[model samples]
Target: MNATCEPRSPRAVRISSSPAELAGLGTLLKCVQAGVGDVPALLALAKDVGDTAPRPGAGRTALLWEILASVTAVDVAAGRILEPHLDAAAILAQAGGAAAADFASDRVSDRVPDSVPFEGAWGVFAAEAPGLTLEAGDAAGRTVLNGSKPWCSIAAQLDHAVLTARLAGGGRAAFAVNLHAAGVSFADPKWTSLGLREVPSGTVHFEAVPAIPLGGAGWYYQRPGFAWGGIGVAACWLGGAVAVARSYQGALQKAADGGREPDQLALAHLGEIDRTLAALIQYFARTAARIDAGELSGPGAWSEALRVRGGAAAAVERIQTLVSQNLGPGPLAFDPRYAKRMADLSLYIRQHHGMRDDAQLGALTFKGGHPW
Candidate 1:
């Protein structure tokens, strides 16, 4: 062994907020709005978070999530429940790993309601490939992916996708493929029962076509950013909750001024939703801090993150129930926007991995094996 490898004390790494990060995020959001999906812009955004290094702490995932969140915030500000846009933001945040936890919290306050959509998949296909039999291959030195990906939010609008596929060697890989590439196609854009109708989500098909590799094969799951994707999904749900509460409050104010009795149930529901958002923000903040400090390493840290995500999913379900009940048949009248908002929230929150049976099983396995 090299003498230089003698046991060394771990150096303390401080987790400080970066104004530059915030500014960069703002600039990137503007570019996204301007249709600047050029490679130069993407690379520049990557560099802002130190994405080119051997191990770029949070990597591209964190950047993607922040970008998504900012765009969703823009939509929320415009009073439109753009659930697909919000889902995109969540997916990007979870791409890199737990490193996005801080990025998510710090930037949530700055989000604006912009109508731009992200051009990448939310990593659902890639993350689920190992167990789902999703497949990819190379044809004539150009990467090709073939599979059916359900619930690709913004599929119709996106120009490209960072798609994931399995290798012949029983491993996984990812590639960036243009949606307009030869042999690539999408199913008819049908509106779901839920409120977010603009997403244009549908199935996508791929025959052998050209694709640019993302990270190395098998690197998608093993990367830290993949786990953090849940946090992004959680943040989007929380944002939806915020939108619902705002709508309820506005309705309550109108009823009060009109000499109508306040909807006591709606008020109570708003309180519960508020409480959940507060707790989630605090939990995510602490988790981010711990991960930054390197204290949240190993299986235990991942388990805790999963628990947070599951809890967020449950809170969202409760909020949706309460909102629908309080709004009553008024939302269904087609005049009030409450119904649409509720529909958007319902569809968006259901996108999380925790909503699946296997996700629950995975969480149980981690918790049972280690209490840390």
Candidate 2:
């Protein structure tokens, strides 16, 4: 995929604490909180000639951009090339929420060297199977693959996919599979889930489909970037938790009517949930800053990312309890908003990478001798 790498604007440059920076991050968070529908429209307008890139301006949108820009700046500070590919994928994922499949479809042709490996894991997990093996043979004048990848995330819509296959050397290699090629098919075409329903998390079957190699065998877990991406996934979980917490606040205001006695038990539960979320957010922010400062490296960075993931997962569970207790039993049946919030929260919480055995191991490695 073609991308232009221009010098980053002043705003893109990493800076120490500043009011302008804080304001920017707040705007980005607010934008994420407001909703995802406005993003395409914003991007479209921002693309016009002679028009400056859209700023968050006065509203929550500005705050959301600031937060995102701050994060991006951190990446820049860490000596990472701030590629549009990474930023675009992150933006699309956030903007589309569970329904990001539509956006993924349009960007299918823009596959990069890294997309295959990243989405390959998603496919394998969706399959919920023991493993996936990628194979290559001559087909349609090119190398082709034969295997199945379930829960390909944007696989149903994307033009190409990065697939993993077992090598003769007893390791795995990621191959890029073209979705539109002959012998490539999607199974269970009409499936949908509660959150990220638009992601088209279905099964993909490759019958000797053409494929391209992504690096060498055993590159998946060997690369530090993969671990870094795991941290980003945790950030997304934190975002979902933020959404749930905000939704709970709105629900609480609506529940308070005519000076009704606030349920003491429910309030206590909500308070605890708030504290948990706050702690997780702080940890995430701190980890991100450390990553920016170059203090976290090697396994230490991965361990910290896992810690954030576990913290986020626990926070989500607590938030769910708060939502259920505060909203009461009747809200689920009567309030579609509450139902949607719960559904979204539940689906987002299932991101399994954070809770994997490796993450647990990382936690143990980091928290040696620490008392709970």
Q: Mark the 10 consecutive residues where model 1 has the least summed lDDT.
A: 1-10
Best by lDDT: 1
Model 2: per-residue Cα lDDT over 1-372, one tens digit each: 011111222222122335655544444333333333233322222222102222211122222322433333222111111112233233323332332352234443343211222231112221335675445554445445677766565455444444566655576665545566677777774756655443446667777664555556665455444445555555555555554555565555545643544477757766887788667656665655565555554556556556666776777777777666566676567655445556655665576554474557555676772224
TM-score of each: 0.64, 0.64
Q: How far is candidate 1 from the true structure (C-alpha RMSD, Å)?
A: 14.2
CA lDDT, every prediction? 0.49, 0.47
> What is the alpha-carbon lDDT for the whole of candidate 1?
0.49
- Candidate 2, residue 124: Cα displacement in angstroms equals 9.9
